[model samples]
Target chain A: MEKLRLGALEAGGTKMVCAIGDENGTIYEQVSIPTTTPKETIPKMIAYFRDKGIDALGIACFGPIELDRDSEKYGYITTTPKLAWRDCDIVGQMQEALHCPVGFDTDVNGSVLGEVTFGQAQGKKCVMYLTIGTGVGGGIYSNGELHHGMLHPETGHVLITKRTADTYAGRCPYHKNCLEGLAAGPAIEERWGRKAVDLADCPEVWELEADYIAQALTGYVMTVSPEMIILGGGVMHQEQLFPLIRKKLKEYINGYIVTDELADMEHYVVPASLHDDQGIMGCLELARRALENDH
Target chain B: MEKLRLGALEAGGTKMVCAIGDENGTIYEQVSIPTTTPKETIPKMIAYFRDKGIDALGIACFGPIELDRDSEKYGYITTTPKLAWRDCDIVGQMQEALHCPVGFDTDVNGSVLGEVTFGQAQGKKCVMYLTIGTGVGGGIYSNGELHHGMLHPETGHVLITKRTADTYAGRCPYHKNCLEGLAAGPAIEERWGRKAVDLADCPEVWELEADYIAQALTGYVMTVSPEMIILGGGVMHQEQLFPLIRKKLKEYINGYIVTDELADMEHYVVPASLHDDQGIMGCLELARRALENDH
Candidate 1:
């Protein structure tokens, strides 16, 4: 019997990572397409997978993407800040071209699903994965599935109190000091006048960054209370931010709810083990699940 | 078959509401017991239901209550601020005395479950029920089930930016300016020189209170994205606070994600139609589910 082949697309703002893989998420073929417009990018993805004869396709899309499987606009990417991609029906186009089952979800949800299925949060009943990139977003995997509701969880937009020492108005046009507005890569750049990659060694930058991240994580801890929180994305590469975030999480939690996991923060809050591959791997997992649900 | 009788106990810091009801949550008999020591209160509850011959029991407890059924201490209420009730195994005691299957959960969760089952949130797939009493807390009922994870949601502790005009340190022992600390009844009294009940007529007092609540609800909206939000508890009784919170919720959202639900704010955020009986009725629902799940 032949192993099941799956097409995975990790679509982002800057680039689209396209891959053809097996059920195990091992990439047999891969391609990277720089994001220009829907016309240029979606075709590249469709062309790559069209002849691959993959059983199904999974798309981890930069959203707010529609996920209601029954809606007429279910697969459409609606209301994105990226003007060119607004209301783009990436799923519909792909399905129309390739004629296969397509799984669609936010990039963060896919990332978390990847982590849960094959990475850090494997076998955990409750888990959270956060990406602190140009913006902060998270995916909640609870009870062995990605948690989705009215819209997908907009964890990035959750409002967080501004730090006493920091006075920069947040970069988010919506909520001025929300977690993303305060702690995301763009917000950090705006506040420190340097990109997060350049300011990796600056203690003061990480201290405040960690402060905001810690506060946001504390909110997640209190609200979602996931057993494990996996942190990833561009800014998290700064190794110095981890301990600071862990320490502040402890102080902010204040032992109101005592747990051995809280005491040993290292075991609970962790960096994503899959790193860059999480997107494609998660997409593969999404594809597999979509196929399974079809049966 | 005979109608199944279930006993429900809505235990709070102030009082205990014990009731016997049917599977439809119709109360046949009810009793109110003033909250005191475990020795005083638990027995009163035991005696009330001991002879009632209930097939199953449910406890809607003011927590943090242990919900993990497999743990040795699964039914214990751990780490409550109420000194007399700390670490009380309310579920175990009642189960031992009454010899019936017992369902247990936080009071807010019970209320939301009740609301979803038979009250205002009926037919709503995603809903949130919030109690803004001495301490603000909430329950998320998403996709027709009570949302639970590593632990129940500690929504009260979600951090919110304090209103610039309000200078009072929050009342929560942990995270001084958390939603509860900034917006709870105690916080209201401490911020202004009067309790929420007394300050009902003060437009300025409710304005700040509404500001903080709106910010918190905005966070919940961005994170949970519930279809309908049912606001209960003592502070919410101030009828003027509703429109102010709805208006601020709209402003905080900033039209980033457009929903018709957001346009009609008055219908989205509503008072708890069940008012105070949500707890015992929710417990009744819990008991009925427990009995059903047993098979």
Candidate 2:
């Protein structure tokens, strides 16, 4: 089979990364555009790939993006924090402009797919990916497919135990102290009055941050029982948070359920290996799958 | 295809419920045997099923049972608090004695499968079944198959926030404040100085108990995003606990992820429609699957 040119887009809250890749996920051309509004951003993304001769486009977008194929708004970005993109039919617009098949999913889901296809989670049956950036979100690859049900796995919105000493009230608009509210990048900045990167030396900051993340990870471990949990995004860049999270996970789970993966904590929970390219590569994989299915 | 006779067993901590059924999960005859030492109990179960012309046997036993087929201890009950049956090779023994294909999983998983196949969750793609009996065990049917990884989901041990006024350390031997520790029948008994049945009228007791359950269910809903959650077991029999749980679920989730199921409340979270027969009938379905797979 001839290798087909593919288009990949990693649409974030701040910017959109548009790339021309191939069936093998190798990028041939890529560009970034500021996410001013759907009207402006979607057109720029489509124009970048218009002459790329791609057979299909795959989007790993900041969501809640509608992925339900049966819905009329299936390819539209639904109620997201990025107010400008809400209700924007990014996939439909791209398909109309490029006249090619398109695939769409949450950015976190794309990351997990990227890891499963090309990074640390390769060959793993049950894999989980979590991004703790401006917000907390997770993607699950379970039973050899990206898991989706009524919605998606809303790991960030799940409640977590609040630390008794800290009373900062969380930053999330919805659940005040949910995993996202307490542990996301903005949550840390708001709680401690500084960005996570600047607070690396403060044990108090990372300790509480790690505590919240570990608490949420414990929930993931117990419920999803993923073979590996990959943590990424801005906050996880703090190297010390990993050990604290590993320790807290052990403390929380308390050996009630045992597995070699849990015992070897180092392998069970680790930072994402794909780095920033996960979303783009994952989008390429999704595009590959779409084309393969079409065939 | 000729219908095959199937044998189903629900091995509980106190007693073993044994039944002879068919592929359709219809019981031809059923009996109960007290759970004793494996030497005595295994022989009695074997004696009952012998010469029954069963094509397959499914054992939905009290666990933590090893379910990984590649492991040396695949069918053995491992490290269960039920000391008499710990490390017992229930499925291997059954297969050896009956000379037929054997299916084995946690009793909770069996119940979920039963519900999916023959009860309330029929035709549903994503479903969760939780048993809050002597212990708080759960099973998930996600993406249209029973979910299992590492070990099957030990959801009972996931941590929950302790209520402010409740000081009792909880009854679980491991993880003192876990979901099972706080909301299991024994947990309620230990916390309130009475069994769940005896404390039926205690609003405070039921309210706190319902709060912990709802918290755990919130985690389940967030992670699994199941179409339905079925609550079963002795603790759920309080009946009043259901409304309290539904109310608390709405509180914890707080509309972060919108779904029609969450809005309805009553339809999304429900009691097991199969009631007491869920585990046995689930075992029968497992037996049926085992026979079907053999073909």
Candidate 3:
């Protein structure tokens, strides 16, 4: 199993990052392909994996994927803003071309799986990975598996209470002042009239940002009860946000769940240790799991 | 399995309802014992099961009971309000005396398991059972099992936004305006200066109650993505609240998740069909499962 070859694809709207890896999370070969259309993009993927001669492929795809394993459209990416890829049969095409088992899930779920398998959440049974960049999306990993139900958790859209001092009209078109609208990087820029990286010097700006992230974490904590929570993406580069979010998370939790993880804020909620490698590494794990489950 | 005799105990603060049943959820003998102290109460349970000749036992106990089966205090009723039974070893004593595989869980969790196995949520893969009673508590059953991470889900204590139209200060001493504080039976009684049963005629009261329940349900739906949601408990007895909650849940979800279950509100959000038998029936299923898992 450790020596088995796996193909990892971090499928995105802009591009796809493909890597030939192993069950042990080592990447042997990698390539990036531009995403144009199904015809243009999928052939490039098939060519990459075919050349690699992989045992299995794992796709950390940009979704609204049909995650229901029993669904006829199980591998089709439905209703994505990437109009060209909408309703595209990504997994089916890859599986047919590569002639191997394929595991597919949302990118965020992949990142969490990566973290859980080999990164920050190494030994944790229950964990959540949240990416707060242009949008707020998250993945749930619990009982040594990624969560997929009606769909992978639409975490960003969960409604949250807004602060009294904030007057900014939230940017999310769907639900205004939702966790994503109030806390994501774009929300920070819209709220402070400056980018999050630039607004770091202003202490109050981060305080509010941490407040929203913490509130969202509280909801996730109550629902998923993750053993550890990892925060990633561009906005978390501030470093100051880590302590602030952890503190506010404990405050919001209000001592209901009395455990070492909840009491010790310093280590419970932290940054994604894999840095930029979370997706590719997670995809590799997914590939490994798909191969194992297939057999 | 259907021929095996099982013991079901609905352990409450005021009384303990013990029943001798089988895998088919048929109760042959039953009795109510006053919950005075372990000395008086537990012997009655042992006596009941000893005579019944059961193969397994299930205790649907009032909690903060130790749900963590691996912990040293696995079956101890920890920090309960019933003064004498704070740390009562209910499961341990029952297992020792009756000498059968004893299953134990919180009453709410048991009710949900009951629904999932033999009642409303039968054949459903993912479901949430929320009881908006003296307090708003819930149980989650997904992937054909009860969810117990960190602890069973403490659904009632979650934070929700205050509706702009209402200005009632919430009653929960822990979190001021959490779901339990805002929408529980006591909250309604406090707000209207009457019991829930007395206030059923007021259409607006039920509307507001439905709105708050809908808000909490929205959070659950987003996180759990349950296939069906069952509403039970005393406050839900107000039959008018069902249609109102279903309508409001759809409105709050706002078509974010497109599914047959979400589209059909009438059949999706429903009342418990088993009526007063939810606890005992769930316990029977629990006993049956414990025996199966044990073997």
Best by lDDT: 2
Q: How would you encode candidate 2's per-residue C-alpha lDDT over B75-168 as one tens digit per residue?
A: 9999888787889999988899999988888899999999999998898888999988888889998876788878899899888989778899
Docking class of 1: medium
lDDT of 2 at A55: 86
Arranged by TM-score, best first: 2, 3, 1
What is the C-alpha lDDT profile of model 2 across A1-295, one tens digit per residue? 7778988999898988999888666888888899898888777887788888888888988888777777888989888867877799988888889898888888999999989998888888899999998888999998777888778888888888898898889887777668988888987888888877989899989888888998898888889899899999988889899999999899888877788889999998999887578889999998988887788
Clash pairs, model 2 backbone: none
Stretches > 4 Å off in candidate 3: none
Interface residue Cα RMSD of candidate 2 after superposition:
1.0
Assess the local accuracy of residue B290 in candidate 2 as a C-alpha lDDT between 0 and 100: 81
Query: Who is ahead in lDDT, 1 or 3?
Result: 1
- Return the DockQ of model 3: 0.63
TM-score of structure candidate 3: 0.96
lDDT of 3 by residue, A1-295 (tens): 3489899999987889999988878888889999899999888888877877788999998877888888899999998877888889999989888888999998999999998888878877778888888787888886777876667778877778898888988887666657887888888898788867888799999899888888778877777677888889889888999989988888887766776678777778988888588999999999989999999
Off by over 4 Å in 1: none
Q: Taking the tens digit of each residue's C-alpha lDDT, what string does model 1 give over B26-108?
A: 89999999999999988988989999989999888898888877677798988887888898888889888988889988999
